[model samples]
Target: MTHIQIGCNLSYTVTQTTSFLFNIAAARTLQQTIGEETLQLNPAIHFETFTLGTEGIQVYRIVAEPCELQLQYHAQVELYPDRYDTAEIIETDFQHLPYEVLPYLNPSRYCESDRLAHFATRLFGNIPHGYSRVTEICDWINANLDYQAGSSGESTSACDVLIQRVGVCRDYAHLAIALCRALCIPARYISGYALGLQPPDFHGFFEAYLGSRWYLFDATRMAPVEGFVRIGIGRDAADASFATIIGTAALTTMSVWAQ
Candidate 1:
């Protein structure tokens, strides 16, 4: 098992009553466990904690009046992800897919599989199927796309990234997810804390369901898969943003770390 210490600090200037929904906690999954952890707010305020579906994604909701808000979170996580051999991990047939896994095959907001269907099949159509194909998808994305910080915005989709050929980690995952879905593989988005990430921020990765399980992949190749501590899982980045604010607030500073 790999043990990791992860945390983030967010400072915001609230000019009016603001409601913040934060998904910054380490997720507790079958392969991941959380040890001692804490989430604190300066001038401690009442907050609601909730879990989303079966992913074990924990979210914190807080309402704050005009003030300098400081939010801090820290955690100890142990990861023991399942290991599989590339040749042994074969793709599952559509008719045999689990009920819950069906949603991932369809197009989502950022991962528009429908639009990229022809392009994906044309480029990766001849590649051998299964785990290796998925790996190649990530490799192709890493080689083709330029990783520029301000190249993409919240509205950027997989198709957008493909055309521009420039994006951050999130865009890499989106395009990979879209390509996988177009090739009939069930893929989903993941937000997590990664070890060895150059800038040390929350990382974007993806998972493709194969051989009766979901295998993680990082198109950016910034960190090892086992070092990733999942924070949230969703159809796309839209559903797994670290912070979702619904009022007047401006983020003054932010810092994230994982070791």
Candidate 2:
């Protein structure tokens, strides 16, 4: 088990009536345990706290009327990651895949698996199957793309990253996931706090379904997979944004940490 402290501080200027939805709270899973947590607002505002499904993504929702909104979140958690044989693992056949896992095989807003299927076959089809092929896909992205900040925007997708060959962590994960799915492997995106991540902030990674379970993979290799604390899982970034705002809101400042 690895112990970690992670959180984010954000200040926003709400010029008009706006609603904010947040998903920054550390997730609780069988492999992860939360010891302590605190979520605060500068004006001592009231917000509704709720959990989404069984994912343990705690949501903090609030509406403000033309005011400076300051938000802070801190949590202590221990993460437990199970080990698996990456080289020996085999891919699950489509017919045997669980009904719930079927959605991940489809193309998403960020991961255009359908469009990239032909490319995936030509690029990686000759490689051996299963985990090794997936790792090769990860390595291909890391070697081809430059990890440049401010190189991408909110609308960046796997195809965009593929053409530009420059992006942050999520872009790396998105492209890798798209390639994995294009090759007929079940893959999904995950948002989390990565211990020992340089320039510490929220991180994005992907998980490939192998054999009978899902295994973690980070194309960026910015942090240890075992040290990652899962926060949200979804088809892509659209389903896992840290914050969503309706109406005009200018972000004044932001800070994040994980250790």
Per-model clash counts, in order, read 0, 0
14-57 per-residue lDDT for model 1 (tens digits): 99999999999998799989999999999789999999999899
Off by over 4 Å in 2: none
Which residue pairs clash in candidate 1? none
Highest TM-score among the candidates is held by which one? 1
lDDT of 2 by residue, 175-255 (tens): 999999998899999998888898888899999998888889999988989899888889988888889999889999988
**Using lDDT as the measure, which candidate wins?**
1
Q: Over the full model, what C-alpha lDDT does candidate 2 score relative to the true structure?
A: 0.90
Q: Rate the local accuracy (lDDT) of all candidates.
A: 0.94, 0.90
**Model 2: clashing residue pairs?**
none
- Give the range where candidate 2 is weakest over 10 consecutive residues by summed lDDT: 79-88
| Model 2 residue 207 distance off true place after TM-score fit, in angstroms | 1.1
Cα lDDT for residue 151, model 2? 97
